[model samples]
Target: MENSSRDYSHINGWGIDADPKNDPTYPMKKRTNEEHRGYSWQRPTQQAETVEVLHSNERPNLTAVFGTTVPPSGLSGMLRRYAFKHTENEYAHWLPLLLADRINVVEGIIEDFKNGKVPNIFAEKGMKADLQHDRAGLIKKAVIGGLLIGGVVAFMAGKNSNKSRKLDY
Candidate 1:
């Protein structure tokens, strides 16, 4: 062992294994012919691209393992496709992807209703858990949501009233 100018003796367990005889793996320090070799087996076969797999613009080819469950199809899918056109580094790529995710949630809810299944949005959103653990946060969100909806309704009503007045003139 070479002596260093900077002392590491302050550190706990420092130089504990300075003596090779004290080393745990010293007994099993046998070198093998294949010890320095890379992976022995070839890469597992790449999953077949049966569905429309959205890949980053940077990647030349699809990855070995890629998801195929949900292929792009609807409006959200179109936004996602547009998003993928731009580089991942730009907001143009990310913002549309974020918007698409929100849109997909709404789409899912609509699809549930269309299938005659009334989705339990509260349970699905973990509101019960929020109520138990984060009551204040849940209340704050509800208040803000109510205020936003109220403001929109009021604005629409005012716009309708203004149109009605214009018709009377």
Candidate 2:
């Protein structure tokens, strides 16, 4: 390999930290004897597995701490189990998890209704905050959503009409 005489020291801010005095963080960057102290503490005892905890297939065991509240259940739970079967690198693992989250939201709303509680969706969705802070952005999103829904309805109506006309012939 041929060595070229290309000097990068002339560039602005180049080797700025080469001199400890010129370093902005020199004061806070002090190395104490305590800095060499390694992690000597023992790992905490693993939490008891009380619920259906879904973990990545790559992991040998569950973490020391795990959330017990809202254990996996219903259709979303099944989806989560399926996702855990596959490696995290695959889209098969993530797509079902994403779908499961959407299903879980619907399930939550249904569950709320079943419990004689009418959820305040407007407040839950933070629409009031959006109206106050981002009125224009909120309006734009509403318009786009309305248009998309209208277009789908129009297309379905047109397709149904065409099918009915074909039956007449």
Candidate 3:
């Protein structure tokens, strides 16, 4: 009669060829694929090796950008913190769009001045006085545009702050 411990099978090429009776850890109870959630049963040796690799804490966190550190918990919190820190510590940077707008207004003012009208404020500061006088309309227009842009930027900034707070995890 064939010994039950000496029975061996290699159904899906798992390489379990050696006699089970010779190994102390072999001839163990095995589970079917459906019983282990579609995973084949592993030998004791292979399972030990896999467990050792999984328990090792040698891998680095992949979420952090260069020169930044991230905690293992809650990724969204870390991102929000990093963004807030970056924006808060950095100096105010001039945006190209805003600079372009200012340049356009200055050019408009120059054109208006060249039309024989300069702002009276220039003369009030003890400057040139032979300037013509139709600059009031141009000055008022520039001031109104500047104020509108500033208000919009302020409103959007406040709205963003509130939204960011609401999204905090």
Candidate 4:
């Protein structure tokens, strides 16, 4: 085996100690088994195809990730929390397929809650003031309506009394 450091090539200001071409001594900086490895930025053809297959499988593995127990509030909180945590895990390629499937389901639940189909705990917290204002407006309208009706009756009664007095006189 030839030593790569033995052959020295000089370029402008840089000292090239190792052979740029074929190195007989140290073959292509072999990756150590303990060296941390990760999924390539672009997945391999087989891995991409495998991910596609896993996505289409539809086994409802979200139940495994999110668990069966509903959160303290309801399904919305449980799903939202799971989505956030799942997103972080997905970045690490831990649950890309499962998380991708679940993200939409959880987001749909959140949207339904927004559309008033489901009770959204997040909205409920902020809507207390709005609900109170609506109730107060309804009460005010009822009170104003009652007062207007009472005033009309009083005016009619007064007119009747004046007419009766003139006729009697």
The alpha-carbon lDDT assigned to residue 27 of candidate 2 equals 76
lDDT per residue as tens, model 3, 1-169: 7756543355564444465665565534353435456556543432222111111122332222222232222333333333333333243222332444455556556767999878565555433322344466656766898999999999999999999999995
Query: Which candidate, 2 or 4, would have the higher lDDT against the true structure?
Result: 2
- Candidate 1 vs candidate 3, lDDT winner: 1
Q: Write the per-residue lDDT of candidate 4 for residues 37-79, one digit (tens) a residue.
A: 7535753333212111112122433222222332323453444
Q: Report the Cα lDDT for candidate 4.
A: 0.52
User: Could you tell me which residue pairs clash in candidate 1?
Assistant: none
Q: Write the per-residue lDDT of candidate 1 for residues 1-169, one digit (tens) a residue.
A: 9977898999999999998889997665554645567438777799999999999999998989999988887899999999999999999999999999999999999999999999998999999999999999999999999999999999999999999999998
Task: TM-score winner between 1 and 4, please give it.
Answer: 1
Q: Is candidate 3 or candidate 4 better by lDDT?
A: 4
The parts of candidate 2 lying over 4 Å away from their true place are 1-38, 149-169
| Model 2: per-residue Cα lDDT over 1-169, one tens digit each | 9988787888998878989999987876785655478647888899999888889999999999989898888999999999999999999999999999999999999999999999998899899999999999889989999999999999999999999999998
Residue-pair clashes per candidate, as listed? Answer: 0, 0, 0, 0
The parts of candidate 3 lying over 4 Å away from their true place are: 1-133
